[model samples]
Target: MKNELLSLLNKNLLAVEPSLIRKFDDEISKIPGIIKLTLGEPYFNTPDHIKIAGIKAIIDNQTHYAPNRGIVELREAISEYLRRRHYAVSYDPQEQIIVTNGASEAISTAMNSFLGEGDMVLCPSPAFGLYRNLAKINGARYIEIDTEDDKYELTPEKLKTYLDEYHTSVKMLVLNYPNNPTGVSYSENEIKKLAEVLEEYPIVGECQEVCVNG
Candidate 1:
């Protein structure tokens, strides 16, 4: 019998290509004495302190479902950390902040909330691959501004040019620091310059990207 069960699945999912990163890992693992730099994983096991905390939490019966947004204390700690790091931003733990399982899940939650049918996202090319798929998953499209020629950095002039050419159809911008793949980051001045350009798009929100410099 034909697999009629396939028809009940999401049509959009059919178009998603397998993750290139994972495929690259599988092929590279077959090569003898090859160090696979493409796959991102820690070189060390979990720290002893973290392991102790987990054991303590489990013994204390703290392994229950958390609030939908996340635990309030952890959310507050995140908010404080962002502020202390001179991001100059503050979010309320009770509402604005959410603790997700990982960066990918956070991106999904954010995109699902922000993107609607046919909306567009602007991302610099040669970035982390997940951003492109996240936009598509949310029923939106993404415009990858190729940054290969610019030494893997997105400039304010480039952003302005694209925004002008596209005439405001772009719904969001994805900016990353210590960006994946290229491993280049924006200087404080460079970020300020980009912010100046973005001021014109005051209503545009929900810029999605991952930051993991640590």
Candidate 2:
């Protein structure tokens, strides 16, 4: 029965390897008195105020499942935040905002929604491994454009070249900013240039921003 169940599992899943980040973190964690910074682990504890509010919610019996998109209050707050930070960008809370558990869920949702079998996900090299794993799980091919020679930044010219080469199979572009492993970010002008290149293609761009605070 065990062998039969294993055989029935998705081959794509079986082909996926464990995350090297987590593996390294686990190994290094065993060393005493070492200040480890792997796996995006937070250095600070949860604030007292937030902890109290969470306890209060449980006491008030507000533990039922939230709306599929998320609570309206939270979504509204997110919309307002984007509006304030981006100056000109605004999202409608009721129709456009979705509050995900974390970046992982949000990325998974976007990839599953846009990708199909044999589709291609173009990722910049040295990105978070989750993007590549998720693409494989969705039966899509993950292609990396090495950015080591370009100061670890994916320029518009490089992006356009890859798109042209894999135009047919490419359906999504995965971009990470304040990029993991490299800690590099694109300037405003750089973003605009890439956007101009992207405008000519039909691919969906999945951009991940790393925020320390929830």
Candidate 3:
């Protein structure tokens, strides 16, 4: 039966492994009073106001699927938040904003929109595994740039070396800032160095940053 099920699975999933974090957490969960947050197992409860608002929404028959980009009100609020935080340029809610289930889905969605069969996606490893999975699911290739030797982040010199070696076209490059599980971030000068390397390439990327939920 297990063999038969495997035959029906997507070919792209054949080589994919379940998340190591999730697997370890599941194993430890059997222990008495074990708690984990690596997979975002929240230890806190939902706030009362949020709970009441959700209940009220359900009672008002608001359970229908939202717009493809999600609720305009929420999107607008997010746009405002980004502006308030001075992360980047402010976006128009109706024209630019989207509300995703979480950062995972958001990455999948964006990759699907930009990647196609035989496309190449440059992703630095020692980060989330989902980025690779999403690339496979989109019929694109995931080029894992090992960043262990480079301090868990891609360096400009390494980027240049890969680019020179490949000379192969890249459809997209995924950079996860304030990365998950490690919470590694780039300083201003480090970012400048990376930008200098990328300046040589013709790249088209949306600058909107997705906050990975944990």
Supply every candidate's count of residue pairs whose N, Cα or C atoms clash at under 3 angstroms: 0, 0, 0
> Per-prediction TM-score, please?
0.89, 0.94, 0.82
Best-performing candidate as measured by TM-score: 2
List, residue by residue over 107-130, the lDDT tens digit for candidate 3. Answer: 777877887778787767766778
* lDDT (Cα atoms) of all candidates against the true structure: 0.76, 0.86, 0.75
1 versus 3: better TM-score goes to: 1
**Model 3 regions more than 4 Å off:** 1-10, 86-88, 204-214
Candidate 1 per-residue lDDT over residues 1-214, each given as its tens digit: 3468778766665667788999989998999998779867887899999999999999999999999999888989988987788576776778778889887788677667767777888888787787777777677778889998899999999988887876456777777557878888888899779878877763253333332111
**lDDT score, residue 76, model 2?**
90
**Which ranges in model 2 have alpha carbons more than 4 Å from their true place?**
209-214
Candidate 2 lDDT over 143-198, as tens digits, reads: 99999999999999999999999998899988888899889998889978988888
Q: Could you tell me the C-alpha RMSD of candidate 2 in Å?
A: 3.5
